[model samples]
Target: MLKAVILIGGPQKGTRFRPLSFEVPKPLFPVAGVPMIQHHIEACAQVPGMQEILLIGFYQPDEPLTQFLEAAQQEFNLPVRYLQEFAPLGTGGGLYHFRDQILAGSPEAFFVLNADVCSDFPLSAMLEAHRRQRHPFLLLGTTANRTQSLNYGCIVENPQTHEVLHYVEKPSTFISDIINCGIYLFSPEALKPLRDVFQRNQQDGQLEDSPGLWPGAGTIRLEQDVFSALAGQGQIYVHLTDGIWSQIKSAGSALYASRLYLSRYQDTHPERLAKHTPGGPWIRGNVYIHPTAKVAPSAVLGPNVSIGKGVTVGEGVRLRESIVLHGATLQEHTCVLHSIVGWGSTVGRWARVEVPPVTLTPTIPEPAWTVRASSRTGSCCLLSPSWAAESGSLPRCSS
Candidate 1:
C-alpha cells in the first residue's frame, strides 16, 4: 500500500490570493470546474496501490474543508482525511508530527505534494525511480528560465547518476535551471532525518542564552533544513519532467491554470467538454458546462470557459477565457473575457466585462464602461476600463 500527503498551509499563507481566498481557502478555490486540490487527489488516486490521502494543514476543519473531505473520499473511494495542526507547522514539522500515522500499515512509500502547484503530476514515474534505487528522498524537478528560477529551490545533481549534489532554496544568485516542483516521494526511512532535525532544535534551545528565543520544537523546513543539509549524501535524487507545471500564487495564475487544465480535458475528460448540439450553446473550444446551466444557442463561448451550476447564458453573448460561476446570468450580448463572474450574479444585457491581458508593460487597460453583477443578496460592481485604470486592479465581484 502507498499513501500521499498534501501540505496545504492555512489561511495565513495564501495572502497573495485576496478576495477569492476570503470566499474559500486557496487550496479549495476552483481551478478548472472543480476545487484546486481535486486535481492533486485525482492524480494520486490514479497511482496503483495508493491507499490513503492525508491533507496536512493548519485549517480548522471548517464546513468547506469538512465537506470537501467527505466529497473527495466518496468521489475517489479512498480514506481522505485532514490532519490539522494547532499552529503553523513548517513543512517538515507536520510530516514529523504525523510520522506514525503515515508509517502505519507498513506502506512502501508516501508522496508529499504542495497544495498551490498546478502540474501534470508525474507520480508513477517517480515511484518507478524510487523502486529502482529506494532513495530516501525523490524530488520532482523541472526547468525554469534563469530569471524565474531564482524564485524557487534550485538543485544540482550528477548528470548520469541523478544524485542531488547541492540544493539551495530561493537563493539570490542563480544556481541551476532545475527547480523543485514541491512534490516528493520518500521511503519510510525518511522520517529519521526529520527526527534528527527535531532533536537538534531541542538541544540548541537548551544551550542558548535565551531558551525562549530559539525556534520552536515543531518547526522544520523540509527544504532548507533537510534537502540542503542532506545533499551529496547519496540520499536525495531528482526526477525531471518537462510537462505542464506552474505555481498558482495569484488569481491571475489560477486563471492561467484553469486554461491549462481545460486544455488537458481533450484526453482526460472529453465528456465534460461542451458540444454544439443542434439546439445548445455555440461551443468553440475546450469548454465545460454544468448540466444545470441554460445556454442559448446563439451565445458563443469557449477557447477556455467554464459555466457552473444553474448559470444562464443569454442570446448572442460572448464569453472567452473566463469562468461564469454558479447561477450567474450573462444577459443577451453581454461580452465577458478574462474575468470571473461571481456566484448567483446577474449581468445586464449588452454589458461587457473585459480584463486587460496581465503584463508588466507600464500601461494599464482602461475599462470603457461599467457593469453591475447583482446577486440576490448583494451586488458587485465590475467596471469597464475607466474605473479599472483608476483602481489599477481588476475587481472581483462576489456576494
Candidate 2:
C-alpha cells in the first residue's frame, strides 16, 4: 500500500503574504471558495496507490491541525490524519522528525508534497513510474519558464534514464528550465541519508556536521542542506511534467492562483446563471448570487463574485472581481472594480474603488481587493485606492 504526507509548512507570516495569512492559516486560505490545501489533497487522493494521508504542520496549539483534518475527512470520506509538529521543521527535517511514526505504519512508498501550491499534475502517473522503475526517491520537476525558479532550485535530469544528475540551488547562471516542483516520492530508504549522516557525524563528535543535535536544529532547511548534499551523489531522480501548476507562496501569487483556478473551473463546469430578476447581470461563471439580493441591471458581476442573502447593488453600480459576503450594498453609480465590499457595508453613491494607482506599476499586476464584515453597516464614505483597516462587521440588513 502507498501512503502520502503533505507538509503544511506552518503560518507563512514572515513572507510578504502578511495580512492575508494573518486571520486564517495559510493552508486554509480560500482559492475560489475552497481551502488552498484541498487542491493538493484532492489530487493526491485520486491516485491509485494512495491509501492513507497525513497532513503535517505546526499551527496554533489550541486547535492545531485537527480542524483541517476533520473537515477533510468529512468532505473526502478518506482516512486522514493530522500530525502537529511541535516546532517548525524544514522540508527534510519535518520528514525526519516524523520518521518513527511513518515507519510504524510501514507502507511501501510515501508521497510528500508542499501544501502551498496548485497543480493538475498527474500524481498517480508519477507513482506508476516510480513503481515501475523501483526507484527509492523521485522528485517532481515542472518547466521553469519564470525567473523565480533560479531562486528555488533547478534540477538537471538524465533525459534517457530520468535520474537526477545535478541540483543547482539558486544558481545565478542559467542552465535547465526544469525546476523542482516542491513535490517528492520517497521510499523508506530516503530517510537513511539524513539519519546516517546525523548518526555518523554525531558519533564522530563533529557537532557542526550534525545540525539535528542542536536545539533549534529542526529548522535546518532541507533544500539548502539535505537535498543539496544528496543531489551530489545522484540519489534523487527527477520527473519533469508540463502540467498545470502554480506556486501560491505570496499575496500576489495567491490572487493570480485564485483567478487561474476559477478560469479552469469554467472550462470544466461552465457557470449556470440562475434566471432570477434580482440576480442582475451575472457573468456566466462559477458565481453564487443570492436570490433576495437586488443587483441593478446596469451592475456587472462575475467570474468569482459571491453575494450573500439580502445583498443589494444600487443602480449603475459596477462591481466586478469581488466577494460581497452578505447584505453588502454598492450605492448608486458607484464603481467597485477589483474590490470586495464587506457584508452590510454600503459604498456611498459615486464612490470609486479601483486598485490603488500608487500601488500599481507597469511591471506587476495588482492584488485583488477583499472586504469582509459580519454585522456593521459599511462606512458611508468614498473608499480610497488603498485603505489600511479595510475590514469590519455590520448589522444584518432588513431589505
Candidate 3:
C-alpha cells in the first residue's frame, strides 16, 4: 500500500494570500470550484495501492477543515486525517516529526506534495520510475525558461541516467532549466537522512550561545537539507514532465491555475462543468457552478469561471476569467472580468469590476492589478492604473 502527505504551511506562511487566507486556510481556499488541496487528494486517491492520506500543517483543525476531512473520507473511502504541528516545521521537519505515523502501515512508498502548486500530478509515472530503481528520492521536475528557473529549486541531472548530479534552491546564478515541482516519491529508507539532519541540528543547537536565535532544530527544509545534500550520491533521481504545471504563489498565479484546472475538467470531471440547460445561464467555455448558486438565464459566464456556493448572478451579468466566491451577489448588468469577487460582498447594479487580462509567461512579471480581498470586510476596491502609477504600489482596500 501507499500513502501521501500534503504539506500545507501554517498561517504565517501564506501571507501573500492575505484576505483569502484570513477567511479560510490557504489549503482550503477555492481553486477551480473546490478547495485547492482537494485536487491533491483526488489525484492521490486515483493512484493504485494508495491506502491513506495525511495533511500536515500548523493551522488549527477548525470547522471548515474538519468538514472537508469528513467529506473527503466519505467520498474517497480512504482514511484522510490531518496531522497538526504545534510549531512551524519546515517542509522536511513535519515528515520526520511524524515519521512513526507515516511508516505505521509499512507503505511501499509515500508521495510528498506541496499545497501551493497546481499540476496534473503525474504520480503513476513517477511510481513507475521509482519501481524501476527503488531510489530513495524521486523528484518530479519540469522545464522552465532559464530566468524563471532561478525562482525555483534547480536540479542538474545526468541526462542519460536521470540521476540528479546537483541541486540548488533558487540560486542567484543560472543553474538549470529543470525545476523541482515540489512533488516527491520516497522510500521508507528516506527518513534515515532526515533523522541525520535532525540529530545534526540538535548537536548544533547545543553549541549555540543564544538558542533563541536559531530557527529551532526541528526545522528541516526538504530541498536544501535533503535533495541538495543527497544529489549525486546515487540516492536522488529526477522525473521530467511536460505536463501542465504552475506554482500558486500569488493571486495572479491562482487565477492562472484556475484557468488551467478548469480546462482540465473536460477530461477529468466533465460533470462539474456548468452546462447550458434550457433556462440556465449561457456558459461559453469551461465553468463550474455550485448547485446552490443562483444564476439568471440572461447572465453570461464562461471561458474559465467558477461560481461558489450561495453565489447569486443577476440577469445580464457578464462574468469571464474570474471566480465568484461563496455568498457573493453580482447585481444585474454587472460586468466582472479578470478579477475575484469576494465572499459575502455585493456588486452594485451595472458595476464594472475588471482589470486588464494578465498573460503569465517567463519573460513577463505578473500583473500588479490582481485585486486581493480584505480580511476584515471580505470586499476589495480596485485602483485605476493612473492611481497605481502615482502611488508606485497598489492601494489596499477594505469594504
Q: Give lDDT tens digits, candidate 1, residues 1-399.
A: 999999999988977566567667889887778888999999999999999999999988899899999999999999999999877778998999999899999999999999999888999999999998888999999988787788889999998999999999999999999999999999999999999998998877733355554347777899999999999999999999998888887656766788888998898878888888887778898898888989889999987898888988889889988877677787777778877776666767666576665531111222233444443354445555445334423343433
TM-scores of the candidates are: 0.88, 0.77, 0.92
**Which is better, 1 or 3, measured by TM-score?**
3
> Candidate 2 on 1-399: residue-level lDDT in tens?
778888887764335555556556778766655677887788777777667888887776345246777878887778888788887766766777788876666788888888877777568878878878876688888876556566568887788888877777778887578888788888888888767655654566644465645434444455656666777465788877887677776544554566566666655424523332554574545565666877777776665555656888877766655556456777676665444454467765666555432332211545544332212234443333235223442222211
- Report the candidate with higher lDDT, 1 versus 3: 3
RMSD of each: 5.2, 5.8, 4.8
lDDT of 3 by residue, 242-326 (tens): 9999888766677888999999999999999988889879989999999999999999998899999999999998999988889
| lDDT for 225 (candidate 2) | 63
Once fitted onto the true fold, the runs of candidate 3 whose alpha carbons sit more than 4 angstroms away are 206-213, 361-364, 370-399
Clashing pairs for model 1 are 366-385, 367-384, 367-385, 367-386, 368-385
TM-score winner, 1 or 2: 1
The whole-model lDDT of each prediction reads: 0.83, 0.65, 0.86
